[model samples]
Target chain A: MIKKLRIMIGTNKKNILALTFIFSSLLVLASTQFPPWDVPVEANDLENPITVDKKNLDAGKAFFDLSCKACHGATGLGDGAVPSGDFTTKAFTGQTDGAIFWKIQQGRGLMPSFKAVQETSLWQAITYIRTLAAPQEIVAMKNATIVIEFDESNSKKLITAKVYETLENGEQAPAKEVKVNFFIKRYFADMLIGGSNNYTDDNGSVSISFPEGVPGKEGKLQVMAKLDDSGFNPAGLTEEVAWGVEKAAYWNDDRQLWKNNDFVPLWLLISFFGVIGGILIAILYVLLQVVKIRKLGVGR
Target chain B: MSAETTDIQKTGRSLKEITSDLLNPIRSKKSSVSLWTMLLVFIIIIGVYAYIYQTMTGLGVTAMRDYTSWGMYIGHFVFLVAVSLVGSLVTAILKLLEIKWAAPITRIAEIIAVAAVALAAITIVLDMGRPDRVLNIFLHGRIQSPIVWDVTVVNMYLLISVILLYLPMIPDIAIMRDTLTDRPKWQRKMYKVLALNWRGTDEQWRLLKRSIRIMLIVIMPVAFAIHTVTSWLFAVNSRAGWDSTIFGPYFVAGAFMVGAAAVIAAMYIFWATKPAYKKYITSKHFDMMGRLLVLTGLVYLYFNVNEYLVPGFKMQKLDGQHLMDLFVGHEAPLFWATQIGGLILPVFLLCFKKFRKPLPIFIISIFVIFFAWTKRLLIVIPTLLTPTFPIQNVPESWHHYIPTYYEIAITSMTVALVLLIITWFTKYFPIIPIWEMAKENGHDNPHEKVVLDDIEKD
Candidate 1:
């Protein structure tokens, strides 16, 4: 009967072990299955306006190195720290430029939205991503200049920048289709102020509304406009504006609990030293009594 | 006092017999004792080797990483600190309460306390990755830190415990110096110097008693402070398991329970190994200790209920996760085992008279002590696992804590060192106070009486 019971117990143990193994495997499979990201139909139908060239590809590569390389891998093989989807796959290359642009513009889960990135830069990044699947050749551009002007009318703050190109005979003409990005100069990186889709019109001028509530040092903000088109040399113009709230410096050096040891609260110090001193004195008295006991023993 | 004195005198042996019986363990050398000592020394040597390797390599050798940084070493430190409280419990608190039965076991408790606390100090150093730069704590020490307070109180308690152990042993040392003439010259001289020329004169007795009375009172707060400050090391943190106002009292109560179990375990060992110890440390002592364990166990149980149930009921997000881990998650088995086997069952079993017998209670005490160590680990590690922020960016192995062999070796070394110190003390000094036992048998000055008896014999 004991041997029969032992055999039954062994079978039960095996069954339980098998069940646990199967359950853990199922859990792992379920965790790896992520939901599919949905993109709007209109965003998928949008067309890429920027030309795929060496200059634009380099600019795209710079942005990809800064943000996407950490999660998407250096060569886009999905071998990065977080292990993203392989960009070199036919599944990835099969997607339309418009679909990829929408995915980048509207990220899901671990992917972050690139909505704040300038439209030209986003298109340039897409151009560089094409090379991750297969390498491409280089190209060059001509030089151009930009001039900026600020206007405050009907309580609306506006900034306009005019783009022009110099001909070989020294004649100047409007530089149409040039991308002009408006920014506020701040510590670290420049804060992008206008919408991402700013482009020069037939008159070679683009106007953008300056945003409200920008914090500046003593109400002075350096507004800058730059022409960073792949077809021309980059040029910039800066103008100081008082359309910012004055940033106040805050300082606190009070003697509080969180302060350093030099500024320890008085009550804590008193209580700490008071209690420690009282106990030490009593211990000292006890030690002194031991000495007296030794003396008494010796006197005898 | 007179009635009790007469009662004890009925079954009491002569003062001379009392002295010899209590001191016999020191005089006789047993092979088993030597074997035990050798075993402890061997383990300590392994621990030292592991520690050297750890220092040469780095803490990377241990499983401690970004998370679960405080592992078995800190847990062992808490255990030592907890066990060390038995010193103040039996030696000071019982002595102050005028509990006469505790006199024989005071030395045992004091020895355990001294060894445990001393090793506790050492264990903290072992936990440090840079054991060499330990002086940075002193060189740049700030009074605002709980660590500084812990250092201060632990050192003070060590000093007071040593004095408490020494002051009571003076009369015994003097007896050893005069009577143990066949002992090695260095041993005799060592006793002579330590005895401080203790002649058991009325004046010397007066000074000795006065000093002991002062220490017995003084040690209470320092003892409380040591463990309370130690508790603050955890309670001061805002972690779910450790963040509680009652942790100070909770820890103190638990310390008392664990310390009581340690004393019983030691009592049984002495009673079993040294046949002479059976005469002095009887079943009656075990029975009393069992009752004390029941009392401390109940108090600790009360704190444990408050510590867990209140938080468990509310089940705040982080606290809920932490409590669930302890109650039904990965840690539940060890947690339940500690609560039931270590605590609830022992407390319940010890209440009955049959289980309070030497053999049964000794077994129970062993379970209690073992669980108590694991209980400390539970208190430390589980809360760390349920950190406020999710554990990310590290390897999956870093999520859990399983102590490496090197860590285990170092921790075992601390335990072995405590046992070795206790064993060495038992080998040299009387495990029970010779003079105190004689005094209980109605001799006013047992030390002088032994000298007089010697002169008469000569």
Candidate 2:
């Protein structure tokens, strides 16, 4: 009888488990459909009015920081003024400049209408928006490539910059005597650090060194190598190295507890331990009294 | 002034007869296995299963996200700690004051305290995402954090409360060991070991009295410290509802109120279940508990006024949103109902002589206990929702905290576990102090009942 009951229970359990699996798979399939995002046909064909020049990009960045940064985020990573949605998807950059312009002009849901900003300014914003894609991706270069390496293991800050020229058959050859400018990245702009301009060696590498114990925010020194816009499109890359594992010295007066200050007050320590100690002693005394009573019986 | 004389007036029974009647509970203390007991066991089993599921699954089984980091579990933690303070109030404060009416209720109060505090510890563990990392609190604890202080005081309070509960029960355990001859052998042996050779000698009585007195004196501050430190956990964070200089005393006063109400509820339950316990836990005991509840309630009411109304009168920008939320927003109805129906109506009703009757007091105390728990939720949830900085870059779902099915099941299990612990304790031991009642009736040497009963027959 028990064997028959066990078989029945086991089969029922199998059926239940199978049903649960099917139900969960159905839920997974149902959630894959994306919501419709309507776009105008004219937006795809409209040409960008603003040129991708240095001056226009800078103005666009300034305007983006003022207005669009609140919603679209600083790097347009979708972590912005909005509470929902991943705005940093590839779809953000996949759209044409005109499509992005139309989206900006026509606000949907939480997005506000940006028609208030003029056409040239909007186009410039779009130019800046193109740079919002992953900064680590090397822009395709016909002539040269810039690579930066930051090494901070030793007692000195070392930044190695190398430039390579691409031949017609797609082979990389070292480009000697190329001037590389190394800068430490700051809040708004990069500060020229150590040798601002140094020519690469025969190996196509330029190494710049700075003194140890230099202070930086959050214990990081961002080293940037720039090949200025002289012949080919100016190429630059940045790499961060550890400085000191402490906040910048200028922020020493900050009230942050983790930054090497006495986090706890002395009085709090005394009061807490004092209470604990008193309780411990009292409990000890009580237990000892119980033991004493048990060991020696009371007299008549 | 004679204890014997008072017993004669109260029950018209001599010391010997009274002691025999009192010992009846210990002799007859078998597991009755009622429907209620069975139901509690079933629920407890389900609760344990839920907790295991929660542990295997992450705390994500609950709907708690970044914004609503704390939910019902924390509220229950604070509530349990608050309710546990009744042990200190009844056992220590009343003992020191020598209130004779409070004598019968201390064991019940202590049991509630032990059960609530033990469960309060578990409730906190439930709130942790990684409960195994709990040892890290001790390994690398920063004395700076209120969390460290909370842990220190809560542990201390638990130790002191347990010792206080045990110290008084030793003589009673000895009484059970000697008198309950027909009880199960294991039970008798358990009592024998727990009794620690208590002989009712003068030295033993002196030591027990001295130790109890010392523990009673020591436990009060530790009890105060536990709840005060609990309050600081929130108050130190600078949250709107919690960031007040008055939170420590406010919480302590509110704790006493809830603790008293919890004791009254337990007294009523015990009074209802044990048909033989009517003489010991009389309506007079309920009357005294009612007055005590009212007294504590008035103090809690005063703190509640200071907590809400003063800032509420001229609401500051930071305090405004929190106050409005409690006053007229989503939480307004529950908040107002808890305050008026739970707090004010009970206080007003308790002032009347008719309401102080056992059944009426029990009903009101039920309201008080219910409100006491919801009151902690009000304090925790509203302040969290109205954070000083605007919430950005999160889903709208993160804005509201709704406890999931698993969280609710686990919380309910903690309550059931507390009841189960209390149930198990009441099954073996006498709920009232057998030896203390004998001594109060001038049967100072409790061993005489075992020795003299056979002597009288011979």
Candidate 3:
């Protein structure tokens, strides 16, 4: 059986050992340093007293902003402006609600104890903390489909788009009065192709016409309609059509430090090399003198 | 009066008496290892074991984390480099300025410098999480990085210190080669090899003096560079408490203060242990060093005030929290103690002539060294903890750094290792320059006199 296991794992002993070493290292890294902190048996066994409903969530959020936002950040992502204990870890979230309440009541190190806060309020805060799982942007967008359609009946080159809300039965109905943007896509970013006063009408549709000679490949035009709303993922739909003259790619010679182009200022280049090069050369010269002196000794 | 004539008219110890007196430490039977040495060795063993444990377990064994990345190790490194600069200050700078009284103290400074710089190098490596990747620094070093500058200056400082330690010891080594012919075969061979076959020819002496002069001139800037670049490792960062123009001079001033204190501490230890060299290291030397310490202390005090006061007064938004922590918050106790006890109190003590005596000076130096070490800890840790924005997702323990037992052990090991280096060096070497003392006392080497005259004429 041992021989069969060896054959299944690796033929060579060294290879098997290397694989074991790598796998064990990964296991160690995956494990958190936070061992289970001691909690009172009462606290450990107790369930959160407050019901987790919308009212409790709002209450929890109010308290969280009041007490914890400075350190725990708005979303409880441990990115507070003030230095404090990170509550975003599995080690933190894995604890029972009572244990968290106890910890908050009796703070350690940089974390302040919230003993004055009522137990029900603390429970509400814990509920808010729990709600901070990754935001539901993608899921919300998937449930709302946006469609763009083009009509050029009068050769006016008009484009129309619509937003539809998906029902529980997987059926779609028109969504009304939602703002939409029509834009032509560019290399660095999308260029808005329509006016700012654009939105879906009561019928859930937007109509706009193409502007002059926006160039693309082989006189092809690419335009998109996007649903722009705060706290929601932007749902976009794009359409391609042969409409305008083709334009060759052009270069922008703007100088920026992050772009890695060799457009550094002359004085900066001179000063950097002059100072660092001078110091290095001076140090090197001194070292070389030591070598010369060592050579002057009785024996080489 | 010419130097040679004045030496003849001075407190005349004959050449033979000087030679025998200076060489007694080296030629005598090796002193049995003291209990202190044994204790140091034991601590070093434990430290090595702890290091092995740390390497196996990773840096998690230490209390350091993303926020407070550096801990006691970097603090200890700063202390080592600070003390090591005394070698340049005493030996090279004083010798170049032609200070006659500094001769007996020069070797002590050089040995301390050698040991401390060596330890500084080792301690910095110990600070690295993956020390094996240290070679990658040289292989893929960015010239613009402050770390590269630190490495460059530190290595240069080490090389210069070692050479400076060796150059003046050549004549003394020759004395050992000739005098200790009756010693063990291995020791005799070792002395012979290290002595560089000095026949005491006039030409050789001239060349030696010229080399020593060149090294002295070159080493001053290198010494200053080593510590300045080290300070820049923090100062170059935009972090509060570190983002000041005064750090370079501030660090240099503080280094000289602690360096002088270290030399005083060593002087007391050596003077108390070995009575044979009582004539060589006298109370007069202690008085001079005490006065020098007071000057450095005052300068360091001025810089310390400038370092803190300007920021505290302006209360710039970035530095406000850090200054508050240092001034009145959790860090205030250590901060105030370091300033008052380490910098201000030493100056106060050294100001009185009565305290400039050897024993009082030694005790004061102990306080200085201790406080200086803690001061470095304050410099490295509090600023790191008070960074403007907090690093996310780390355990709260990352907010405040308290070095673990492993860190304490490794730091203690480096300290003990430096002492061990000094111990072995004192055991094997003369610790005082026999020929130089003899020459200074007007036991004229006729050959050297001719060479000196010729060089002066040319």
Q: Order of all candidates by DockQ, from best down to worst?
A: 2, 1, 3
Runs of candidate 1 exceeding 4 Å displacement? A1-253, B1-11, B29-33, B445-458
- Summarize candidate 2's per-residue lDDT along B291-393 as a digit string, tens digits: 9999999999999999999889889987888899899988999999899877899999999989999899999999999999999999898788887898764
The better candidate by DockQ, 1 or 3, is 1
Candidate 1 chain B, which ten residues in sequence have the lowest lDDT sum? B446-455
Give the TM-score (0 to 1) of chain B in model 2.
0.94
> Per-residue lDDT of A96-152 in model 2, one digit per residue for the tens?
888888887876544666766788898987777676574333233347888987676
Which candidate wins on lDDT?
A: 1
Superposed model 2: Cα runs more than 4 Å off:
A1-156, A161-264, A297-300, B1-26, B29-33, B445-458
TM-score of candidate 2 versus the correct structure, residues matched by position: 0.72
How close is every model to the real structure, measured as TM-score? 0.68, 0.72, 0.66
- Write down the lDDT of every candidate, Cα atoms only: 0.83, 0.77, 0.77
> Which pairs clash inside model 2?
none
Query: What tens digits encode model 1's per-residue C-alpha lDDT throughout A61-149?
Result: 76876777877887788766553778889989887778899988776644667777888888888877776776522333556778888
